[model samples]
Target: MIETPASIVADRKSVYGLRTYISLFSSAGIGCYGFKLEGFQCIASVELLEKRLKIQRYNNKCTLDSGYICGDMTQEETHNAILREYDLWHNAFGIKELDVLIATPPCQGMSVANHKKGNELKRNSLVVESITMVKRLKPRFFIFENVRAFLRSICTDVDGVDKSIESAIDSNLSGDYNILYKVVNFKDYGCPSSRTRTLVIGVRKDQLEVTPYDIFPDKQPEKTLRETIGHL
Candidate 1:
């Protein structure tokens, strides 16, 4: 059954000592809902569309009004807003650092489903923004999720050199983070649908107790769509 906002609020666990996260390109806030379920509190979320951001607000995705930001990631305004909000949230909790950064950049340009994939779309370069934020925020852990083609997709890096997304990530963050880039189907990870996605996960070097492999989901028996929703 679909959960309502009130139900979610009632069921919400106290996050006093839990990890904190901020999301970039958080469309409708569904993707980060999983993180909330995992006991992480959202410090802030950025979505370009006001309509989509409203949905996030309606769902109470972030505890503070300032936490829901509507702005373009490419702009300096958005970056500053994120930093300001993160600092306020971080200071309020007296946390040493942000625990996680979850980014799901627009994937239309890199998705195999896009038949018109020819020259790289401008949106593809948005991955660079995700990379830039990771470097700036230096979260203890970070996650990037997109279509399976994302790794091979080309994007201009911070240095303005064109490179595959995989190479860009490796060149920029490998030195500071123990990173893992992998493509896996969600069905293998216990999701109902057979959705394949590329996941890039990073653990800051100082966070030595755990590696990306330690946090990656273990494979599980696949579930069919019929089995998942047939009752409805």
Candidate 2:
């Protein structure tokens, strides 16, 4: 069953409820903050570095009901591990209903700074793995993020077929997903730094498509660096 925002707020008023989430490159679980504040609880996450996962557990007070997988996301083992968790959820009568899946595959290969080696950097193709996982999981919502350079970068795949990153993503994730993306700067949302990124959101056709502006409504009263850092 698809959950509308009203139902989510109504049902999760007392507890975070069972809206599931899985984050890739979870990075100490910080990315879930906004969603968590809105009452979505993470069920699992994957991060490559053990130190980061340990820090995540520490920050969450070691009380998370979520599972964390620390491993190279490009590897099949990582995929299988996540699948097993989902299967367990289903067997436990949880419906395996993943409300959201957010990922930030490593961006180094797509960064212009890495062009010193030409854009065919091996890690550039790792995004295909994330796309493949989305195909398998069929989450209600998914967002893939990376450096802004990712939007125009071209790189060869494992099959030696060179394609634009956007094309590759479309080809790989073709289906009910309505893909939306924009180059957005966090400063517009009162962030202290002018961090810009390419954020791609994929919603199943049945789900309402949302934009960066829809996500961050308070872009004005325009924050100044002085206001942001005055305490520190």
Most accurate candidate by lDDT: 1
User: Which residue pairs overlap in candidate 1's backbone?
Assistant: none
State the lDDT of candidate 1 residue by residue for 87-161, as single tens digits.
875565555688899999999888778888767656888988999999999999999999999999889889989
Highest-TM-score candidate? 1
lDDT for residue 14 in candidate 2, whole number 0-100: 56
Give model 1 RMSD, 1 decimal.
4.9
Q: What is the C-alpha lDDT of each candidate?
A: 0.86, 0.71
Clash number by candidate, in order? 0, 0
TM-score of each: 0.89, 0.80
Which stretches of model 2 miss by more than 4 angstroms? Answer: 1-17, 61-66, 114-120, 155-160, 208-220, 224-232
Candidate 1: 10-residue stretch with minimal lDDT:
1-10
> How close to the true structure is residue 110 of candidate 2, measured as C-alpha lDDT?
73
Global Cα lDDT for candidate 1: 0.86
lDDT of 2 by residue, 1-232 (tens): 3233354356455565667677887777775656666656555688888888887777552113346788888789989988877776556534547778888877777776665665465677777777778888998888888899886677555456878778877777646687877887878877777788888887776666663335433565557788978889
